[model samples]
Target: MFGLIGHSTSFEEARAKARSLGFDEFADGDLDMWCSAPPQLVEHVEVTSRTGKVIKGAYIDSVFVPEMLRRFKTAKRKVLKAMELVQRSGIDITALGGFTSIIFEDLNLLREERISAVQLDWQRFTTGNTHTAWVICQQVERNAPKLGIDLARAKVAVVGASGDIGSAVCRWLQRTGVGELLLVARRPQPLVALQESLGEGRILPLEEALPEADVVVWVASLPQSLTIDTDSLKRPCLMIDGGYPKNLDTKAAAAGIHVLKGGIVEFWQDIGWQMMELAEMAVPERQMFACFAEAMLLDFEDIHTNFSWGRNNINLAAMDLIGEASLRHGFKSLGLEPASSSSPALSIA
Candidate 1:
């Protein structure tokens, strides 16, 4: 069975989920874990290249961020408990979704924690960032033209460039021929290493990187809101806000900047089961963050290895593999919500 570890995006959502899970009352920090009913794929979803692979799995609610993430100890405990739950439920591979993936940047810490709790092999875990990068790249390619920006000549800046998803995104943009690339992160060392390997791009601190970018990819691993003054970016910028807790202030988008919720793909086919019933979670339009989709697609491919682990190690081959697997599984972003040039900023508050 496959397992997805995630947290509610808001307190209200958390309470609703808890009640549905049979909890009379669930406070902000309470965690809940439950198994999904066998996901019955409809004809449209089942006729994909995978023929008909039905995935049986479980999902964990890591709860909202403020309590779980306020301190490392609390976050670590919650993650360990979730891992234990997945292991006990006999899930072969568990995808660490949303904020849970970011709590421990050093996978070794997570590894030790896993061993302490379940003694399972590290290969049983993955962050699923490869599919996330695939979705982000696809969004950029699909939306750039409409935004009147030529990616071939656009100045693209990737915040949190040293992280897994951000680095993969940089690689994808380079392959697509972005004219200028700027890598932004807290430190310069990792950025330097990435630039040396890619043979291009300039590395700058976060503050210095914003004003010059035509298309800003804010995909940082920050636990809290980023401290950038949104007003600094060049106007008419296309900002792909890919952070889990979301790093960009919506006010920036309110001032006429184009912002697209990144790392998510919406399924347009007539899937017989609603996402809420399938996963027992609240998500709009059967759309899921690419990170979570990675697990489902990998299950279809029977690729049980640690497909995406650690930071900054995702190569183009892995990205391509997940992308293809997604398509074969009948996953398409075609009619899903495209990042609108006139849409309001996302509310992370």
Candidate 2:
């Protein structure tokens, strides 16, 4: 019995992937994978994505303050409550996704029960091919010849440049020939480092600098409740929300600011269920997720889990590698949404 725990709403896609990995999809339309039980062939465990169902567990880490510790304790209590329900219903292998894995990422919760823990890398696999910034830079350059969007004429502003992802984006902007680059972040250290690495430029914090930018890229993991006054964002501007959980409030963002969202090209073949097994077995070892490839490969010969690469700082190289790998593997981008008739959307968000 494999219990995949995640928000069913947001991770319907991941659930599908889990099914591809041998989980079965029952008549209820929930994921049911073949479970490795003691001396038994297999069993069925339902994956519930419903809310208010208690999820019992902990993500305790060695390093944290008292306040953080209290928060973890509360979260663990909630998780344990949910897991208790699943146990009563009969689930042997419990896997956590999204935020659940964040808590378990640090602590070993499986030791407390008969449940097995799992954390699917999802999108953030780090491959060595290209960095996300480099990949975005390449897209800018690649599209420069074809893009009605001119990079040379654009006044660039990279928000949160004091951080890793922001710094990479800034470097690419600098080299890609922005007419002017406005650096926005917290303190002045990274801004100074960027300037030193790429020569003199104007740098300011995000609040003071956003109004003048023609192109603004947000890449930091800001806390919740942080809000951007849409009016401060420039008109006729292109805003790229590159941060996970999204930095700019999509709802509150200025209308017509030309938003550029980011995501990898996912190929979901409705080749139906017929060819799934073959595809799984035949997927090349090198075709693993970019983020966990090296680590995951350490344990197995067929390291195809990370068919797409990932990184915290958004490695453009990993992005490129995933793209290149998918193409080489003859994986066509699935037609999704309005794209249900066209190709999958692949490129920087």
TM-score of each: 0.81, 0.48
Off by over 4 Å in 2: 1-148, 222-224, 247-252, 268-323, 326-349
- Per-residue alpha-carbon lDDT of model 2 for 1-349, expressed as tens digits? 3333332212354345436446444211422221111111122311111221222221111111112334665445434444454444443333333244344433444444532453322321222223334434443444333334477777677776765556666765675578888887777876787778768568877677777776776766556666767677655556555554433544345554555442112223322122213213122211111211122211122232332222234344544554454344333221112223443332222
**In model 2, how large is the Cα lDDT of residue 333?**
23
Model 2 collision count: 40
Q: In candidate 1, what are the lDDT values of residues 231-269, reduced to their tens digit?
A: 787766777878866546443645546777777765534
Candidate 1, residue 345: the lDDT equals: 32
CA lDDT of 131 in candidate 1? 88
Candidate 2 at 40: error in angstroms? 19
